[model samples]
Target chain A: MNTKTRDTLGKVGVFALASVPLLDGIWRVTSGTRLGGNPIETLEHLSGQWALYLLAITLALTPLRTLFGWRWQLKLRRMLGLFAAFYALVHVVCYVWLDLGFAWDEIGTELIGRPTITIGAVAALGLLVLALTSPRAAVRRLGKRWQPLHRSVYLIAVMAVVHVAWKGKDGGEDALVYALVLIALLLPRFAVLAKKRSSPQA
Target chain B: MMRKAISSNEITPESVFLKRRQVLQAAMALGAGSLVGCSVDSAEADTPSAATTRALTSTGSTDFAGGENWTPEKLVTSYNNFYELGLDKGDPAKNADWLKTDGWTVEVGGACAKPGTFAVEDLVNFNALEERVYRLRCVEAWSMVVPWLGVPLGDMLKRFEPTSNAKYVRFDTVLDPDNLKGQRSSILQWPYTEGLRIDEAMHPLSFMAVGLYGKTLPAQNGAPLRLVMPWKYGYKSIKSIVKIEFVEEQPDTSWNLSAPHEYGFYSNVNPSVSHPRWSQARERRIDGNVLSAKIDTQMFNGYADEVASLYTGMDLSKSF
Candidate 1:
């Protein structure tokens, strides 16, 4: 296949893969198949898991580009990051709308009083900022500031892990796996930074 | 309101019970019916077994006067936190069929005069079973109202003859790693254990449930026998109990051993004391609706009237 056709197909594939959970969630709501007894919790868990999975995949892209010199992978990073943000937004909406039934007073209390909720809200906010500034125009305007701002994804990822671990009932095995993945992705970048700093030329 | 004793004739046939559940579910979907006036039936339609399908006789006992609707039987059976089966709420119902509850035995020892092994059938039929609708508040900030049929725990403990040194009661789950999939993973210490002060154990409200919704308890809902302390967090009420030890000192509890800062021996449902991770102020009720608003968690899960005097001099926040 030609480069143009392959690229178009690749983008379509990414979009379709990312859209699966959301579409499944909709189908579950409509048809009530595999929604389990507690539909709200099912959807809440579904969206939150997809968001974390996408965020982890998005973070992994950078390390893959650095290690394999695959420049084409960078083209998908923004779209993947934005999809993560979209799911994160859906997760919060499920919490506020379906879980809490839009009780504004309870929502305020949960945001402020619950540690896990607070940490999750902050991570969602960080993702929101990253999503808003992901456009080409904003990238040019921010220039030097963009890299540092986007680097906050590391902090957001840590918060997400903490949020999940804290909320889990049985010891946080899921969170541990995510933590290990994040560490693996971050280790190569830190090694390169260390090498650059320790060089005699510097 | 006086409740009539459930007669053997009133027992729902398996087919009719399953059909009624489906109709109730449809009515709920149409938003035309609340869970009020719904009768008990076998919950496990997927796993049809003679043991789980058996019906039990239950006379209604004291329940919350607040008129909170019973959480649908499907949710009560499906949504569980039996770590022995799995971590997720739905895991228990799916995986608990592997558990062998027939001819189960519980060993009564440690500071008891008549320390002996008793079969589950003898233990459950030892005293008349009474159905008590209770508010089960989990530390995870979720709640459910369940109709549990069993005798008071104190009634059965008295038969074991707890000695003077029996200051506390420790309950342990069956430790079968080969059968219980969650036991293979070290997420929690094997054979989950829980304890209660002697007084707490003997409290009139502390129930030993053998059945729910007028049917024999499903394996997922802690079949054979389980404790139901309405005033404490749901974890305080251990499931699939195989051992009951009466000890002098406060025995080690699974949650407290796992996270001391978050879970204490006396995990009474107190809204004032927040868990290190989450707020205890409000809890999402597992009613049929996915969009139900969360309700304010009550002090002692609304059993304060009967159980508050038990903790009269102690600080609940510290103990929590």
Candidate 2:
């Protein structure tokens, strides 16, 4: 396809891929199929899982571009990050409003008392910062600092995994799967860091 | 004369009963589809054992207005929290089909006058089976009101005549890996054990449940026998009890041992005592109304009137 056609197709592909989870959630709610017995918990889990999945996808873009020379994958990173942040926002809202019954007192108690909640809150806050500054104007204004500030995705990814694992009723079997994915995504970054440290650039 | 009563109640012939069970089993298996996970050998015709005891009628009181607007039986049965079967709510209903409870015995020992293993039937036959409606509050902030058919645990335990030294009562659940899949995993130390204070054990509200809604307890719902401490969290009420021991000191419990910080020894339904991970102030009623708001959890799950005095001197927040 031509440059204009490729751009249009790429945007279309991103939109369709991103909307799949949200649409599936809506369909489940409407059809009364896969939401399980507890709809609130089902919705919460679905949104949270999608958020993690999108975040992982966002992180994978850099590695994919470097390894395969697929420069086009970089264009979709912004959309994936925003979607991850959006779903994460949904996750937090669902916990506070649907699960907690908008009990601000209880939410406050959870934020302070529970490590899982505290870690999740911190991750959500980081995502919020990235999402807010994702616009072209904000990125341009931030200049060189934008790249460093946005790298907090690494920290957010770790916190997300820890939050789920720590709050698991049984052992962290479900969390372990996500943790493995995040580790794989971070491996390339670690290798690059190691190389930079080894080379005598000075 | 007793034979006539038994024969009259169990009118269907053994062949017919087996056929009906097969039909029901097939229907359940089909309805559940892939969710059941484990397969029961379709070729083998499993019998409900010769020792399958009937639920005897009792003159016990059914005057409980506490559990109003009862949760539907479907929700209650389908959504179980039996960790023995699996972690998922539906896992028990799906996976517990292979569980054979007919040939079961419970060993009651330690500080009791009668310290011997007894048939499960004999234990049920000995007690007057009463129907009691109780609200079960789970530590996960979910609640269910179930009409359980059984006897007062106090009445049943007292028959054995506990020694004065028996300060606590420890109950152990069945640990067969063939039925209890979770038993294979060391998820909270195998052979799940729960305990109650001697006084708590003898409380009028505490029950030894064998059935729900006029039917014998389903395999998933702790068939044969299970302890029902309605005022406390559901975990306190251990399922498929295999052993009961009366000891001088406080007995070690499963959940408390699993995570001391999360699950306390006295897992009473207290709204004030927040679980390290979640708040206990409110609970979602699992009655198919997921969209509706959560109800404020009552102190002692609305059994404070009956069980509150039991914990009067103790600081529940610290003990929890």
Candidate 3:
């Protein structure tokens, strides 16, 4: 397939894949399937998991292109990042509306008092900023500042992993897996940075 | 027996019950389908010990009454925190079929006069099975009202003849890593252990639950035998008990050993004292309502009237 056709198909594939969890959630609610006794908790978990997964996928794209000479994949980053932000939005909405039942006082208390919730909120805010600045017009307007701002995704990803680690009851095997993936993604960047610092003349 | 008035809200809606019934039927069909390839003898041998149903009698005690709506039976059975089966709430129900409850026995040892292994049947038949509705509050800030059928744990403990040295009672869950898959992971100390003070164990409120909702206990709910101390957080009520040890010193508990700062030995449900990770002042009741706001959690899960004396002088905050 040509570049335009491949990109179009890829974007559509990404959109469809990102939507599977949301659609599956709706289907489970409508079909009376096992959302396992606590449906709100289930939905909250599903949305949060997908949000983290999509964020990880978004981060992996740059590493994939750098490692494997793939230019076309770069165009899909914005879309994936936006999808990640969307899922994060859903996750927050589930917590506030469904889980907490719009109890703003309790929500405020959790956002400020609870470490996991506070970390999650900050990471989500970072994703929101990234999503807002993702547009071509915003990108053009920001110029050099955009690159540095977007790099905060790395920090947000770390905070998100911490949020997950702190919230889990079982020893954080799930968080460890995410942390490992993040480490792998960062290693190549660190290696290049280390090499540049060592050979300044080059 | 005088029947306690059950509020209308306490009853599960027919629609929800029917839907759950269908889901359970589907799950049972799938379970049977998987067993199709196994030899008849093997399948027969694999039959759950609690498969046979037994009648239960209600003691008609209103001491621990809360008049809260009963969490739907499906939710009670499916939503469990039994780590031996799995970590996820739903995992216990899904993985529990592997648990072999047949010929289960509890070895009574340590500070007790009669240290002997007794079959689960003997314990269940020790006293007439009585039904008690209890509010089960988890450390995770979730609550459920369940109708548990069993005898008062104190009566059964007395039969074992505890000596003066028996200051604490420690209960141990079954340790079959092959069947209880969660045991394979080091998420927690294996063969989950929990303990209570000698007086706490002898408290009339502490019960040995053999069944729930007027049926034999499902493996996920800790079939054969489990403790149901209504006043304490749910974890204190250990499940699938295989051993009961009366110790002179305070016994080490699984959660307390895992996180001393978080889970204390007492673990009585106190709204004032919060878990280090989250607030324990409020809890969401899993009553089939997805949109319901969390209700204020009660001290001792609303059994403060019956159990406040157990911690008369000790500061709950410090002990907790």
Candidate 4:
């Protein structure tokens, strides 16, 4: 009904959804099953799925609010965005720890050698900036500048989708479905932004 | 078509079999997936009809006198990469317990005068393994030498008499997304589905294998049951099968539907035909020790003479 009510629901949904992947990660580890299909490919894919889910969930909040005109939807944006960041962080941890074996040199090699890994790293870097700016103090300090910094999530979303599309050994229906959902969630916002930019301010 | 057994320079002398211990120590140089287990150790023990896994360096001979001389380490790890069981080469070995084969049955419905489901044990005996060393290849461009033991699929199919109209045969694997976490991800379809032309299903070389390396099938490796089509890519042979539906029209396969640009239903092994993204010409062999120099892959996993007639006129590259 109201923005606050929508925000509460959105917050619950995001947190609960976030916990599923976390629980899955923990269960897999505890069960002694490595992530993904094969051993060599597991941790990275698990991390990637988390990162992809976070970005998608973050992108989804606004359209969800608009579609139903729920005011509370606005309140949960921060939580969803943070969850995206959380998954992205786990993705990074998996890549750094299990995949690269915490070898900085190997990390650098993956970042340089693979275009998907490179784009993913850049997206993570952008999210890092946004995460730091997410705090009230930085938002208050940057004022007008903070808004632009956060908008980078849009780029992060696009890059994240492309990274999976390009790097996936398969076409990755998992990646494709996430991309489609993210697009459905974000397209209306894009049209609104385009309209505002094009129309002359009265 | 039943293949004529031709005596080639292929079968080695009896003396080499007797002195295998001295010649195989240096063999560890091969890579993983080099062989899928039919070794002197796990695949076949020191029984009267068994072969020993001598280290390649233990003896100066780089070659074996009989069918390909593969080690146990190579045999256990080298053969069969069925994704329907799980995604990884090892996933089949790790998480295949959820697959129920005890009450498993195949649907003999398509063209049979009296179509019905037949229990697995009633259909074929699992105790005996028909050992034939063959080349195993993957669509991903890897190969291994395997001494396979099993019966012909056609032999089993013949038990169910067809009245006609059976153009295609489909195999369905057990689908519990909880156990098959990879299926839960929607990479391919949740329950994997694959098919073959009725003739292909009835080919002599197509064997439904229940075990490798002389023991019962391991849980991780499609366990209770799996198929072995030496002439086709690993995927063509379905694993952990629960249902075998015989149909009139062609069936939709999981990989072909998921990515049509890749994965054709006719996934025959041909070195000349390359996949859109990768080469099928060379293979990385996994013999469990050396991890390198496994050797180049041959056409049809070297079973072409027996199966070439299956695809006489069709362009393999385009079909692939």
Candidate 5:
């Protein structure tokens, strides 16, 4: 396939995968099968989980490309990151609008008082910064600084995992699964970094 | 006037009724019913097992009818938080069959005049069961209204004639790991324990729930026996009880032990005191219809008039 056709297919694939959750969420609401008993909670959990999944996937893209020489993976990173941001936005909005009824005063207190929410707010802010700068123009504008700016995603991923771990009422089993996935995705980068530091040319 | 208003059902019972209004408000506020109440099947009736589903006397009136939003028996039975059966909300309904409640005996002792192992059936049969509709608000910010058939906890406790040394009443759930699946995981200190102050334990609202929905208790809903503290959060209502003890010192509770910062012993429904992880200011009614906006949580979960005096002069926010 030509470069343009491959790019088009790639964009289509990203949209398809990302929209699946949104559509399924919508269908669940309309069809009454997936919302469970707590609809807002169901939506909040679904969107938040999807956000974490997409964020992890986006973080994995770099290591996957370096390990397997999958250059096409580079093209998909921005889309996945933006989708993660979108879901994160939905998750936050649900908490603010649905759960809190836009109680700004209480929300302000919660943002500072509750560690779980504070961590969530910071991670969300990081995702927002990354998402806003994801466009090609912003990347060009930020130039060399863009790499470090986007690198904050690893920190954001950790914050998200911590938020889940601390907030889990029953046990941290589900949160631990995400933590394991994040560790697995990050291990390859440490190996590569170690190789660079040990080079004789240095 | 407030009591009369509540009796008149103006205040609305539990979160579900509030949720229905919230859904309506959301439909209007968001300009769409499409977003909330997404599942029609949520209202589908779960057929009771032929063996367990028997017709019983509906002896009690809906005295606590806060609104017309009584939670269905199926949802109440199926969606439970009994960790013994499992952590998942639906696990109890599926796995509780393994719990053999038949021929169960409750060991009652400590600080009381009468102290001995009593047959569960004898205790349940001793009391004249009355149906009382009470709102159950879970600490996870969910609420349900259940018409429970049971005797007053005070009536049963009074029989033992707790001595002045008795400062607290402690209850214990079934401990066998072979039957209760979650017991093996140590998610909580197994053989779950909960306690209440002597005053709180004997309050008129404190009930020893034997059954729900005009029938025998489903194994999932703390079948055979359970403590129902309507004013407090649901976890305080220990289920599948095997032991009841009167103690001088404050008894160690399972949830409070599990996460002292998060779950306090005085887990009264206080919206102001947010849980460490989530806000208790509002709750999503599990029985609410689609589009139900989250309802503001009430102080003492709308039973303030009845139980608020019990905490007089005590700092709830700190004790919480």
Candidate 6:
């Protein structure tokens, strides 16, 4: 693609990402939601939406970049994953700081006690792994194993759905939509895996 | 992409000003409604300690009491949080300005001697405002001490002169989805309907609240009219009313009919019968700077003395 066009897309990503905190801060202010109830629950809901959004965006990047054949889209994967992690970090902080209130005792009680929370914690950890290793150097170091480590994203998305389903009392269309999006994203990977296994390597 | 930061200064005093404004608005409108049923309100609020006040007047009047709990902020912020009109408990102060309160009719029908409609102005312009500190308990397990202004329910019910067969009184709200946009949600039925046993309706504590915090009931909190029963859970108090009916049989209430197991016709707060999903033992008060809370709830929400007789022989657990 042209350098000017690439430069424009880069500028757009920077502009969009920069405004996210402000956009979100405005929501909490105007929505006038009195923050009560489980902080973990609130953060989970807030971050879960963002995580799904990022996963959707990450999956979209390939389809978008391939269909448009744009190199500018390549830079977006890290930014999108980072956004996903930003939300995930909020989710974890809410769980750790607000919900558990930084008490190892309370954290252990919920993590070890509740199945939904345990699965969710693991998914958050998986996302953390991907976020930490998202750099090109990490990919280069992993070599052949990079694809397998990156594949943990699909697992993270699935666990996220289970997490939401278990916490079903909170009203929304999120869990249902996230599951459908995950299915659509994962179907192609499964089909490719099957094709690779079936083809005779000459 | 719009965003606004939550205003600082800890306690925004605007909410308190709104509550005082609400009562004044109702007091202005009270002069228009029927005057005969509201005299009792003065005895409760104005006379302080008259043992015979209960016997002095059958109709309720504008009463006031000041406890440590009576802060201007709590008075306004603790209002019934029905969001059909707006959010932020104080949204009524801003949005209720557009409500068409005058020249409105409150139709009474179904098993009544006079099945006709009366103008809301007649009741407000004529009736005296009585302020009663009624505790409002939401189905979601939060409580508020509300100083409601209105007349006794019996006085209002007697106006229509119900037929001998009338054993229940049903209230209907303005249900036009276009006008009441929150009607879109399939939560509880919109144009909310709530009912009371004929005897319960006649109870002195059961009043039709027109004003709160010594002012007119804001449009958001069921402007022009609403129900107040210190005994029942808050949902039973339907707002923005348009119709009233006296029925021979028990009428189906919105929440009760929607999910009978969770709600009941005799939805008197019984701490023993737990809501299937959550415990009703404790409630959080609406006064702001609210961080640590969880007050023990009483059976019939402390209204058993006034209302327990109605459910003398009934099983509250099954009914609830």
Q: Scored by CA lDDT, what does every candidate get?
A: 0.82, 0.80, 0.82, 0.63, 0.80, 0.64
Worst 10 residues of 6 chain A by lDDT: A33-42
DockQ of model 1, rounded to 2 decimals:
0.35
Would candidate 4 be rated incorrect, acceptable, medium or high by CAPRI criteria? Answer: incorrect
lDDT of 5 by residue, A1-202 (tens): 8998998898898889788878877866786643556677768888999999999989898988778988877888889999999999989988888777788997998898889889998999999999999899999999999999998999999999998887658748678889999999899998888889899766
TM-scores for candidates 1 onward, in order:
0.88, 0.84, 0.89, 0.54, 0.85, 0.65
Better of 3 and 6 by DockQ: 3
Error of 2 at B266 (Å): 1.5
lDDT of 2 by residue, A1-202 (tens): 7987897799888988788777766755685544445678767887898899899999999988666778877888899999999999989988888888888887888899989999999999899999999999999999999999999899999999998888657637678788999999999888888889989875
Query: In candidate 6, which residue ranges exceed 4 Å CA deviation?
Result: A1-63, A66-202, B1-68, B71-83, B86-99, B121-127, B184-188, B257-262, B270-278
Q: What is the TM-score of chain A alone in each candidate?
A: 0.95, 0.94, 0.95, 0.83, 0.95, 0.79
Stretches off by above 4 angstroms in model 4 are A1-202, B1-89, B176-183, B287-295
Candidate 1 residues A79-181, lDDT tens each? 8999999999999999889887787887888788778899999999999999999999999999999999999999999999888887667538988998998
Q: How is the predicted docking of candidate 6 categorized under the CAPRI scheme? A: incorrect
* Alpha-carbon RMSD of each model: 5.8, 6.3, 5.6, 13.5, 7.1, 11.8
The sequence of per-residue lDDT tens digits that candidate 4 reaches over residues A1-202 is: 9966766776787688677767765755564422222222445566677777767766776776656776555676787688778778877876566444566765675677667788888988888788878989999999998888788888898888877776644546546776787778788898878889989974
Q: Categorize the docking of model 1.
A: acceptable
Could you tell me the TM-score of chain B in model 4? Answer: 0.73
Candidate 3: list runs displaced more than 4 Å. Answer: A199-202, B1-63
Better of 3 and 6 by TM-score: 3
Interface root-mean-square deviation of model 1 in angstroms is 6.8
From the highest TM-score down, the ranking of the candidates is 3, 1, 5, 2, 6, 4
Clash count per candidate: 0, 0, 0, 44, 9, 40
Pitting candidate 1 against candidate 6, the one with the higher DockQ is 1
Predicted complexes: DockQ each:
0.35, 0.23, 0.39, 0.05, 0.44, 0.12
Report the lDDT tens digits of candidate 3 across residue range A46-156: 788889999988888887777887778788899989989999999999988988888888889888888999999999999999999999999999999999999999999
Global fold similarity of model 4 (TM-score)? 0.54
